[model samples]
Target: MVMVKFLGSLISVDEAVNKATRAFKDLVELRIIEKTVWDALYYVSAEDILALIDQPRYDRSAVDGYAVISSDTTGASPTNPAILRVKGYMSPSSTPEEYVVRNGEAVELATGAPLPLGADAVVMYEDTNRVGDEVEIYKPVPSGANVSRKGEDYRKGEVLVKKNTLLKPWHLSIIASTGINSVKVYEKLRIGVIGTGSELVEPGYKLSSGQIYNSTSVLVKNYVETLGLAKGKYYGVFPDEKEVLREALFKALRENHLVITTGGTGVSDEDVIRDIVDEYGEWVFRGVAMRPGRPTSAAIINDKPVFLLSGYPVAAWTGLEAIVSPTIYSILGLEKPVKPVVQGILARRVPNTVGYRSYIRVTTRIGPGNKVIVEPYMLKGSGILSSLVKTNGYIILYENIEGYEKGSIVDVILY
Candidate 1:
């Protein structure tokens, strides 16, 4: 007979986090790996990335115009324009030595061209009427106008990218600006991802009447990889049979720093991972008091973390997002990345269970006066993956909160 119980006591999300990460303040010592800047995308930097050279290296024109002495165009305007003789033509390829703007003279230079000596400003072509060698400057420009100064972006040895950063495209460009080709980044945390349940089958194969696709494995694997903290090694679906999952659990724990198992949780006969955790591992938490993924859990086995998540897609997502991600960040001594939040007026009343922290998916639309309107999808189901798919972001109803009424402003964290 199946018995329903929390072998390890249920706890709040915050308490679970405390329990899991309390002993791991100085736990980080991951190996650093060198990667080409091109391949460093998404990897966390292990060292401070410094700029070797100044951006631009020299002052350059910011627009295609006539480089001029700022004093020559003083008080110049459309009615009483300053007429200067064009001294020479200069492109970005031209060296500053190739041209010089003396008194009453201007050099026709393209955008990004090196600013010629004796020229303190650039008057855009649109503001100048050029006829033959003479150009009428209708706009007076101050010194340094329309010019990018040397060392304006970065000076040598300045921090371009800080250590432990998730490197993005702009970070790579900044590094590339200083002619850097390689970066030192932390090696990926290897995680073993396992899916459990006799009814689960991999996609591309026939699903019998009692079977569903093992999408949790795919979701967990991809999500873990996408976070850039870890690379997932998938161990395929296993049945509810205790000995089989027991062997897979031990083997995976031996090979990875973290092991995540989906499906074998909750108070059911088929939820065997919880039993394995109780018998052979120490539970950080067996349950969390949250909606969708109440059975989300964590344990330490063989000196590594093992997270137990739900089988239902959306619930599994909540388990990973709400509990797993924060736990990982805590253990690694990394700050959790903040999600973009947008505030909107509620379109309808959305109530939450008093003690449960609820995650409500929402679709936002621009209303009158450019105001954002949030409509909560009230179809409450832990298994409702489609609800998440149809929404752009979600709102959290904290444990202390009850709900939001119509027209109440709410903050939505973008997915």
Candidate 2:
């Protein structure tokens, strides 16, 4: 395979994502399967929304306050209190056979209890005075007070959750209220991760003169799982041998929907990953114009997408965020993966390079004027893990502009 080098261009992040997804759109398929709600939180597939219907068909109480006929306390005032006898009490879980709420009678009820047949409103327990089962109300309440009318929270057959929503605690509650125990969701994306470098050693091992710690494998694996995208298996670090690299690349591509590797993507003597992908797969864009991640590589191997991330910690992370994330989401058939976009003020003047777009690490906070103040972390080297640990987000210096002035309106992607 002849190696071809291409200088990266300054492309809009959104446009790049669109172009990349369109290039390989038909290769991945979405499979929706029915699964119990209890087993759905393990991965992205189970978190997808199928349907969001309404609550049960009944008028229920929203609070444990009280149940009353609104008309009974129409003219009741603090000076002249209205007293009534306690007719009965009702709990949420139990069904009450007797629903007779006569005038001058107040019924006790718990939170989520269905409104009695005759009660048109409810007075809170705190607002009423009960002297040995005799109830006294100082204020008058209107009809439907303290009551959740039937179909009020949600109407029957009303769709609450749209398709592709990531199920949260509230979503699960919605499903349970809608009487749905199971839902249809998309299948999770399977990811394989390979760390390339002969000198790299895994953590918990003694450091030698010729060895470095293998940080990329664990980092990439955790990164994939944190997004609820996929379960990643780390194949550990391999040497620069072409045959070993080829076997690892081929195996990962054949089994996983996506394979992401760190190290060996740089333009160095030991960088064999890009060459391996070039030999085995259809190479896509091989480089990006963004600093730190300029050496990034991408290709399709055995019909599966493969990404060769930079050996630098921050670069690998940035490239994964900018490229691999969207690809995974698209393969899973998710419409839009919501990312946190924050607007901030540049604390100081930012100098930029002429042709290369820069991603500067920044620390963001709300200042005295309630403005988001972003302070640059000032670390630009690709291998600086300490900078990433201290920074909160990234600030972009566009290719068109030379630099940014203090107090400029800048948009940032919050980490």
Maximum-TM-score candidate: 1
Superposed by TM-score, candidate 2 places the C-alpha of residue 317 at a distance from the truth, in angstroms, of 0.7
Candidate 1 per-residue C-alpha lDDT over 95-204 given as tens digits, one digit per residue, 9 for 90 to 100: 88888789999999999999999998999999999989999999999999999998899998899999878888999989988999999998878889999999999999
- What is the alpha-carbon lDDT for the whole of candidate 2? 0.75
**Worst lDDT 10-window in candidate 1:** 20-29
lDDT of 2 by residue, 7-102 (tens): 365455455566568766777655777767676663343442433444535667777766888888877877787888887788776564556788
Q: Where is model 2 more than 4 Å wrong at Cα?
A: 1-12, 42-56, 340-343, 365-372
lDDT of each: 0.87, 0.75
User: TM-scores for all candidates?
Assistant: 0.93, 0.90
